[model samples]
Target: MRAEAQAYADKINAALALLRRFIDWDKALRRLDELNARVEDPTLWDKPREAQE
Candidate 1:
C-alpha cells in the first residue's frame, strides 16, 4: 500500500514538473503585450523585412 502511495505521489510530482515547464503565464502575457504594441505602431510597416517577421 505504501509503495502504491509513493508511486502515485511520484506521478503527481512528475505532472507538476511538466506543468511548470509548459506554463509561463507571466512571460507569455508580456510577449503578447509586446506583439500588440508592435502591431499598434504605424512605423511597423516601414521596414518590409521586419514587418514580415
Candidate 2:
C-alpha cells in the first residue's frame, strides 16, 4: 500500500480505538447499574445458592 493510504488507515484505527474506549465505559456503567439494581433488591440472597461454609 501507498504511504499516504497507510497513514490514513492508521489514523482511522486510532480514532476507532478511542471511540471503543467510550463504548467500553458505557458498557461498564450499564453492568454496574444492573448489579446495583440487583444488589439493592435485598431478595437476591433468598434464592439459596451453593454455600461456601
Per-model RMSD to reference:
7.7, 9.5
After superposition, the stretches of candidate 2 with alpha carbons farther than 4 Å from their true spots are: 1-23, 50-53
lDDT of 2 by residue, 3-29 (tens): 999999999999988988778877878
Ten contiguous residues minimizing lDDT sum, candidate 2: 44-53
lDDT, model 1: 0.91
TM-score of each: 0.53, 0.46
Scanning candidate 1 in windows of ten residues, the lowest lDDT window is 20-29
Which pairs clash in model 1? Answer: none
lDDT of each: 0.91, 0.78
- Candidate No. with top lDDT: 1
Number of the predicted model whose TM-score against the real structure is largest: 1
In angstroms, the error of model 1 at 47 is 0.2
Model 2 steric clash pairs: none
